[model samples]
Target: MMFEKIANKIGKYTVLLISLLIALILYPALEQYKIGHICLTLWSLITMVAIVVSLNENKKTSKRIQLASGVLFLLIGTLLTRQVLGLSQEFLYHLILPFSFLFIAYIIWIILSSIFKRKSLGADELSGAIVSYLLLGIMWGLLYSYIEFISLNSFSFAAAHDIQAKGSALFYYSFVTLTTLGYGDILPISRFARMAAYLEAVTGVMYTAILVAGLVGHVGRHR
Candidate 1:
């Protein structure tokens, strides 16, 4: 009974989480089109709506909604400034970084709150847990991009073509690091970049261990 109640409470997030996963997965292909940034902006708006709807039960719901609105507005404004006004892409990236960090932080907080409040596992709970892990990889990818923007040559790419260590490349690197796969296709040379990579690797291992242990315990109790 308790598990069902908790699961129902968090079930609202399932659709949103699935949407986020789809968006991330499609992002690389979307980049091939000229309207890719616009599509990404639209996805952000959709995700924001999902977040607001899912968190309607929270105490600061109004504030979170407003925050999401602000993020959308800023993202749109940034996109227009870059595309329409012919601003520097570098400047636009810098402007968007802080708000991006804030938005991702808010998401992580919400997911962690939902996960920790659960006394038992359910399908929704397991899905949320997995999404949270993916979110960590996305967050680190953004951080890696920011670092690359600030300090060029932080990472080396082993691709045949000359690839910039930003965007999908860094995102791929982030997930690889998070999983501790160490494919060696992308190498972090700078001190800070190396530090961030190792930290993500450690976090990935620890988080998986803890999640597995918790799931096992829950199963044992249920049995």
Candidate 2:
């Protein structure tokens, strides 16, 4: 029982840790250190573990399904780490990375849905919701990365750097699009890229409004 409680805490705080990792990766001081690879590897591993742990905590899910999700995440994490370590070729990024993000995004969606269905709002619910928001940005960021990787001209940046040259810029553009900021520093040129940007913008606004209202209603009922 005690061990399970500890695992639950880890699952609850996973998003906060992930957010910190993102900041660490983006920090200019660490740019010279090439921390992106290590940080991203760790981030992916932790996300897998967190999702598995959360699945274990939920009584509604069957043991078999939980075990399957764990196994799937494990396989994806292995591939992701290998790619990050340079043991795998660029082809892995073209294939494995996008699939990995898609899988994790699905897991995050499940976790968020479960949290939202809870009868009362707690720290876990609030944190999980925020994590879901961040995960949306991450998912879209990976998609943009893939788009830029496949076609150098998919997006235009003011600095005119390739996606590999300034990897963080893709993530920056992701959040900018998510919040509908449209800074114009980076513009999506491809039809699909523009469509994705618009979709993210709409989803971001709706998610924020719905989550805020739901949390407020939960709190009010308890009060």
Task: State each model's CA lDDT, in order.
Answer: 0.74, 0.69
Q: Go through the candidates in order and give the clash count of each.
A: 0, 0
Which residue pairs clash in candidate 2? none
Deviation in Å, model 2, residue 85 alpha carbon: 6.6
Tens digits of per-residue lDDT for model 2 on 20-130? Answer: 456545543443354555565565566555555555555655364466556656665666567567675466577655775676577666766777567776666666777
Per lDDT, the best of the predicted structures is: 1
Q: Predict model 1's lDDT versus the native.
A: 0.74
- Model 1 residue 154 CA deviation (Å) reads 0.5
Superposing all C-alpha atoms, what RMSD in Å does each candidate have to the true structure?
A: 4.8, 3.6
What is the lDDT for 123 in model 1?
78
RMSD of 1: 4.8
Question: TM-score for model 2?
Answer: 0.77
